[model samples]
Target: MLSVHEITELSEEFETKTPQEIIQWAADTFWPEIAMSSSFQTQSMPLLHMVTSLNRSIPVFFIDTGYHFWETLMFREKIASEWKINVIDLYRDHRWDVFAKQNIRSLPLEDPNLCCYLHKVQPMQKALKDIKAWISGIRRDQTSVRAHAKILELQENGLLKINPLLNWKKSDVQEYMEEYNLPAHPLYEKGYKSVGCAPCTVAIGVNDDERAGRWAGRGKVECGLHTDMFSKKDIADVQNEFHLDITKVK
Candidate 1:
């Protein structure tokens, strides 16, 4: 129950603390009420290893976007099994099934934002509704939108969003993963620097930004989970961003 002002103050102080220290504080402060989300990508290894190492019981939310690459799903299963992690699978609500099925092929290319909203954002919103805090594996150097994010963000719904790896960079992730002998996503070496749903993701050159492969050439960067889209509770609030006419979605 931290006040907004208090959370802001603490977030500033956290910039000087190690990610592990920040994670430990979050675990101590909110154990059962807290959870973390992972996309099961190569870059996500460090945060996943650190959190589960500290406490194996912390729930991990994995959005099972039905459009994921088969390798991503297999890698996720391998990691969860080997680490004995408490991984929870999240899926889009049944209400969107008919609409989703109808536009299965065109949805991603026609309106990726809406597709992500239905698959990734909405499922995570529903999964996190009962949680007090959410730990995410985003780093500042990954994207321009994430560069300005704080270590702790208090959502409009009062959920505390914690980003322990906010200050970490691509090199830091690589170094930590190597040091800990963490497993990489199967497609990591295949030039899939940043993996997402099949249609939106592509392989990129080695020197490119780690996330350059995600939603390339789509004029879309984020999947809406880390954006203002997450704050909107209803479809009406985000209908303007969609290429699909969602007014008749019922």
Candidate 2:
């Protein structure tokens, strides 16, 4: 693996390379240690296509909250078939118990943030434990928080995050998918630009639908996995408040 300075230099050079070149570089360098996480969103088409095109066997971890839309599950299977990717499913083992204790079933009805904490974020953190690098299809224009996302990042947990398409625009993703004749998830045509759990994700009109329905009136857009899901300060606070050891949740 390259040193931090070496990584920065190579990352600058990587900007001009095509998607295939980047994937090959990752495959040759990271090899079996690299993996991807996909929510099966239509916007993910380009990255998924690129990874599959490289013909490398990389694990694609899917967080199965068991609350996803049926269409999402179908799309997951479809992509796995097309790409022949190694599929790894993750679910919170105590999900049912936690949901029962917390009474979280639907969208805003349940604390969507905690629901994501117990289901998606917790499982994802554990599933990614051995992975040194993670690749995601995040783009700059997706949200305010992502505007500064780099092509590569050193995550809080020391995981190397590769956002090869961080520079891509929504139109860029659409164009690549169309050019490659990639089949889009059926939900995209239904006006769902951002896909998540079925209840939290409802169709919206194209006009200023900046993830409007996600977590609905709760005003919470993240599942804690992306945001404070596991911040160092927040973890310390939680541990102090609960009078519990840190390793329990981690």
Candidate 3:
């Protein structure tokens, strides 16, 4: 457990290092207790390759939202088998039938915040319960909300969160992938800049931002996994509106 001052000092020190060097520091500092959380997106290949190269046995968590594209799932399997790394599949504990009963087949359209909470955030929270530290491939330029994020952060739950590729840009990610001959996500070539659940993703034009296609035209940018989701009133309203049993979500 690193103190706040220690974390700040380390973040400054890591600012000048390459992504691989930062990952190596994390591997040396918190090997057995550290795990990587990957969405297997286009930007993820570089970090995934880097971490596995350091320690193949480090757990890699993939939140299986049960609504991901067939291609994404297939690609996940391909990477897992090729790398022979420990890939843990995390899923929401709720039954689909309950959501279906509430006519919530397309929650991302009706209530994306709740949808993300149930599908992505909750599952990830459960997966990280026993983990001391976690690594992600989030880069500063990926989203405005994440633009100011540091390379190292202490999450609200006291877990250490490490973003080794925080300073990387899209071009850097591409170069890393190309240099290693890593395969791109099948949908990336189809114009999907940011891939999440199949329903919430779309193809983007060349002039758009990398995440412009996500939740397209819905005025929603993030899925609540990376950003704060709801206020107390917001949660209560959602619970009341959908007759949702918040207690059962976790």
Candidate 4:
């Protein structure tokens, strides 16, 4: 593994490399210890294609929050099957089942941050615990939080978060999709450019930002996967942002 300073220097050089080149390096460096996550959305096609093409043995983590659209689930199955990619489904810790079940209908609307933490963030954090590297598809132009992200970020836990597509824009995704003949998410044609949990996602006009439909009007642009929240291990650390009472969780 590269030291922090070496990783920072290499990350800088990676800014000038293509997404595929960066992905190849990650695979070469981490191999079986490395994996990638995807929402199986339209914009995720390019990175998914690149990573799997470079190495099919790398596991692809998909957080099955149990709140996804049926279409999204089916689309994930189709792509994984057709491409022969190793898709791994991740779920929230079974410990939260009772609480999550009790507020299933209202969680997403009332406290999206906590809802995401329980379903997406926590599951992903647990899934990557044993993994050394995680490849994400976030682009700088996608959101304000992501705009300042580095190509390679070393987490406090010593995990390497690689953003191969950090510098790519929506145009780059489209061009790659067209060139490789990748299929779009089923909801894409119906104005759903960005897809997440069915409750949090909506369709938007072509001129709208690529992520405008995600957590729209909710003052939430991220689900904590790319933010500081991913590193947090205690619920108390984020209690203020949640509506649920953590004291009663047990």
Candidate 5:
């Protein structure tokens, strides 16, 4: 486990390195215990390609929220097959059953935050429970909440989170994808700058924020996975409301 001081020092060290260099460092530092998370979006392609280039067997986790666009799932299959990457599909366990039991199928409509927690955060926390470190494709420029993110963040649970693309710009991602000949998510052509679950995502127009499409009109910016929006009380209330034992969902 890296101490806070060590994380700070390493963040500074990684600041001078390219995304690939930082990824390589992470692979060397924590290979078997390290994994990458992807949403199969344009921004995630570079990191997925980079991690697989280092080690194809490195686990890549994708949360299947049961609400993703059909194209997104197809893209995941395409990437996994083409790259021969070991992609781990993580889903909210028994989500449909839970929804049925609660007589609620569309939680996002009433409470998007709770829906995200049940479908994304809880499942992800379980998937990453054994992992010592994980790589994410987040860039500081994507959202204001993520602007202050470090290249390396030590989570409260002691898991090390590496954001190799922390310093990458939108143009950098574009160039990398072009250079690598990676396929963009099908929805990208439709102007969905930021992709999440289908219900919470929409197409953004030119001159709009890159993430304007996500959780549009909900006054929500993040999906709770990347931010500390959910408090313990919030989680408890959601669980009680849905009659869900999130930790035992699987």
Candidate 6:
């Protein structure tokens, strides 16, 4: 029940060791219940490499929104093949017939955050169920919401969410990628800073926030997954519409 700042304080106080060390520590900390979620963004390469290279492979969850660009799909396939690792595909329910009933092919254009919560946040919540801890590559410099995000925290999902690279900056990420000789997302060099559903992602211009390109001009920046999940209004909206009831989401 730590406040966000308190959660961040704990992470900062302990200070993360090498990628290899963090994985080993998590093994001891969360044991068989630990899971890692990845987006295959270039910034994630180092940690992904470290975890996948371990003797016992970590569970790598990918939230395949099914709306990704061809390049993204290609990159994911390539990484999975090259790494020879297990990548569990997590997805939103986009069954065409079911979607057609609501006359919605994507997020309700009228309410993009609502769209994001249903398609992205809620699914991920279910996808990570029963896991005592989850790991991610989110960094503090990515955006305002993430700026306060820490390397380890208790997500309102009630899971012990760990962001090992929370303090990493764009520069630290780049250095790690280069040192590991990792392959970056193809669209990354093409100017896409943040990668997501192609329909929702765009290339960032100079001086723009790293994530500003996503859902550009959509009023909301984060897709709801990064917010203070304890907020009554936000959680209620997800529960009422998408059935992400905290009591039953598991």
lDDT of 4: 0.91
lDDT of 2 by residue, 1-250 (tens): 5678877887788778776677777777787788988888888878887886775478888899878999999999988887788878898756245333545455235456556766787788777779888887777787677786667776677777787887777788879988999888888888888889887887878885546757666677666665554463333564464454555545
TM-score of each: 0.96, 0.85, 0.90, 0.96, 0.90, 0.82
| Cand. 6 TM to true fold | 0.82
- Candidate 4, which segments miss by more than 4 Å at Cα? 235-247
Q: Is candidate 2 or candidate 4 better by TM-score?
A: 4
In candidate 2, which residue ranges exceed 4 Å CA deviation?
95-102, 106-110, 229-250
* Residue 206 local lDDT, model 1: 79
lDDT of 6 at 139: 75
Off by over 4 Å in 5: 100-105, 229-250
Evaluated at residue 118, the lDDT of candidate 2 is 60
**Per-prediction count of colliding residue pairs?**
0, 1, 0, 0, 0, 1
TM-score of structure candidate 2: 0.85
lDDT of 4 at 115: 87
Instruction: Compare candidates 1 and 5 on TM-score and give the better one.
Output: 1
Instruction: Give a tens-digit lDDT track for model 1, residues 1-250.
Output: 8998999999999999999999999999998899999999999999999999999999999999899999999999999999999999999988788888988999999988788998999898889899999999999998899999999999888889999999998889989998989989999999998899999899999799888888888788999899874567776666655544665564
Please give, for residues 42-97, the per-residue lDDT of candidate 3 as tens digits. Answer: 87899999999889999999998878999999999999998898999988756544
Error of 2 at 9 (Å): 3.2
Clashes by residue pair, model 4: none
Count backbone overlaps in model 2.
1
Write the number of the candidate with greater lDDT, choosing between 1 and 3: 1
